[model samples]
Structure formats: C-alpha cells, structure tokens
Target: MANIKLKGSGYGQFGGFTPYGNVTVLAFALATTALGAAAESNSTAAVKNGDVIELGILPTGMRLEDAQVIITTAMTAATTGKLGFVYEDGVDDAAVPQDAAYFINGGSLATAARLRASGTKLVVLPKPAKLVLTVGGADNAKASDIKVLVYGELTGPK
Candidate 1:
C-alpha cells in the first residue's frame, strides 16, 4: 500500500495508488453553470467599447437571404475595418462589392449590412464583444437569423 502527506504539518495518510477495492472514495467536488440564451437588457449583448461583433438575428428565427439589412444598433457602423463577406447569384463569387452591398458594410451605429446566398455558409469574426446565433434561415429568398458562434478563448475583464 501507498500513502500521501497531509497539510497543517499534521501527518495524515491517504490510501496509496491502487486498483479496485484498494483506494476508497473520500470526498467529492461541485460544478459550475453558464448563462441562458437571451439578449441582455440595457444592451447586454450590444456592441460596447468600440466592439465589432458580427450581426446575427436574435430569438433564433431569421433566415439568410439577399436584401438590404440595416443594423439599427450603434455597434455595426464603420467607415473601414473589414467587409468580411460578400454574396450574389446564390454564391459569394470573386468580384468587387456592388451597389446593394458595398455601402452596407461601412457605416455608423445602427447602420451595418450583410449578404447571403441560398445554400452557402456565412461567417463573421469580431474583434470585441461576444456573438451568438439569434435567428436562422428557412427557404429561398428569405432572411435568416443565425447566432455568432465565437471561436477561441477571449481573455479580458468582463
């Protein structure tokens, strides 16, 4: 049998390394939980501190489609940072942004745009703030609402 050293300078012995029936259970630990799905009040999920969180529909029902989308929230506007994505003809082909898209990506608070084609994937990576899937798309020629699934560990104070 083996033994372990205890703290408090008091020598306490624990069961040595073993197989079944050798080391018995002494104690257990608790677990932690996470937040629920919901947009925060007073703009909990809104853009804060000059953050550029990718826009996604809240409440999980919006469908992806081709149209003019106005991000009324003050966080989406930017004269220049990144267009991130572009789509047309049911595809995000190789071409420059045109009339309906080029301007939507650059603006101010409550003014941002996005585009999507049927059966294509859209991805957005933000510099600040967190993203989640708010809505999803249905059939063709419809608007889709999706949550922004953030990738990687964000290190900072909340």
Candidate 2:
C-alpha cells in the first residue's frame, strides 16, 4: 500500500516529442532502491505488492496511444504489474472513471521481456493525470531493473 515515486515521475511535460506535432514519447528507468530509501521505512527497499509507482503525468487532452514495460532484469516468481492512470486530483470523474489497470493489467514481470498495451484500452484523458504502475503478486526484491515507455499524442487544441 505504498506509493513509490520513481525517478522520472511527474516529468511528462518535459518528455520530448517526435517531429510530428504532439507525438509524445516518455521513458523511465527504474531499479531496486534507485531512490536509496523509502520515507515510510527509512531504509532501502524493493517494491512490494500493492505498491503504486507513479511513472509520470499525462497532460490534459493527451490520448494514450501505447505503453510498454520492459523488464531488464527478471523479478520474483509470479511478480506482476498493472499500468494505468489516475486523475491529478486523486478523484475519479464519473464520466470517465479512473481505471487503475486500463493498460497492461496483471501482466507478468517475472521474466525479461517487453509487455505492451493491447491497443484496445487506449485512453483520451479529460484532464491531466498520473501514469502509474501498480505492483502485484509478490514483492519485487528480485527485480534488478526495468524500463517503462509511454507513447501518446496530443489530441486537444494546441
């Protein structure tokens, strides 16, 4: 039930875009104890089940086109994660309820592979939101490293 803010969290606005207008690409690298210690425990630790890893922010009007979790180092057996978004205000909007697993839901993290969004669950944000990774199944102490890539486009007026 801990919230882990990774190195690149809240940095989507600074993420570079492709030559084409508003085509955004953001990447985040995560490692075990990369931030050194957790404020809650005051000790270096690994991600645990139910931990919410804030990856970055998606500005309003951005439509999430794709996302990928690349496991650079394998994790513990049965370790899994979900990729999704939450509103910046931390409240769900009734019109478009916040989906905690809108992208890769319950995807495996126990092996070295790239897990990509299925493309069927793309989201067009109504407002600025936080991209997140929710750890599941087991503690990820065995995970050495991982990389997250988020791809999107700004569909709203410039």
Candidate 3:
C-alpha cells in the first residue's frame, strides 16, 4: 500500500511544518481497480450530464471510478448507449441514485456520456466510499457482452 500526505489543501506562506500547528489537518487517500465481466443486458440506465455514478469499493480500502473499455473488436454503432467499465461489482445500483447513468456529453476523457460510433475512451473520476462499480449499457443491448475497464481512487476528508 502506498501512503502520502499533502502539506496542506493550499500553499501558505508561513504554514507550520507539521499538524501540531493551528488548523491542523489530515487526509487519507487510496487507489484501486475492479471489474464486471458480462454482456450488456436488461440494464436499466439513463445518460445525462454531470451525473454521478458511484462505483463500489476495494479490499484494501478505496472507491470505484469510470474507465474506458479497450476492446479489440470494434464497437458497433448499433451498440450505441452500451455502457462499459474497467471495474466490476463497483456500481451504485440502488434508489435515490441508480448504479449507472448516461451523460448528454461524453466524459472529460471520452464521451462515455453517449455512444462513440467506432469506440470511446472513458474518463475515470474519483469515487466516493460505500459503492461498487456496475457497468450499464443499452437496455436493449444487455445481451451483448461489453468489456469495461474500471479504475478510480478513494479519498477521505480529515
């Protein structure tokens, strides 16, 4: 396990060298990856903008994030709306917020928000705690198997 502590949230001219000083602060961070191998099936999801799809966790302690699905075979246009992931068992599949969602625009890295005619390179965003990643795809295309690469990190505010 890798460990690191930032001096502070922001740079200060006369900040204390250690946490014993005033406004002491501490933070915890971790990175991990998970997988979900299955064909896109009766998966229920909707794509929109600024949506938060919280993937689950890791054994050591971390969160899940979105990722690009690097497939050797070209993704068919008909496959539009088929969500892919690099992480698995790492999705927020529940009420209040479902496991998967769609963004009107593509992700910061790739347009995972929509279909990439030929393919796509999904962007990985930081995930919160207590959620696993579960890749969603076209509700119609659930029968077709889509390989997703899920990767992300978990950070705690102290």
lDDT of 3 by residue, 1-158 (tens): 88987677552323335544322111222111222212232324332222233332322222233444433332223333323222243565242232232222232222223222222333323333332222223222122222334443323221
Clash totals, every prediction: 27, 0, 33
Off by over 4 Å in 3: 1-61, 75-77, 82-96, 102-146, 154-158
How much lDDT does candidate 3 score?
0.30
Q: What is the C-alpha lDDT profile of model 1 across 29-84, one tens digit per residue?
A: 11111221123332333223323333422111111222233332223223222122
- True-structure RMSD for candidate 3: 13.6
- Best prediction by TM-score: 2
Model 1: residues >4 Å from true position, as ranges? Answer: 1-46, 56-65, 71-83, 86-103, 110-158
The CA lDDT at 135 in model 3 is: 28
- Pick the lDDT winner: 2
Model 3 collision count: 33
CA RMSD per model (angstroms): 21.0, 12.1, 13.6
Off by over 4 Å in 2: 1-19, 34-43
Q: Is candidate 2 or candidate 3 better by lDDT?
A: 2
Give a tens-digit lDDT track for model 2, residues 1-158: 99977685332432346554567787876666543222333346667888887777778877788888998876777888888889999888776678878878999988899998964856668888888888899886553577888888777633
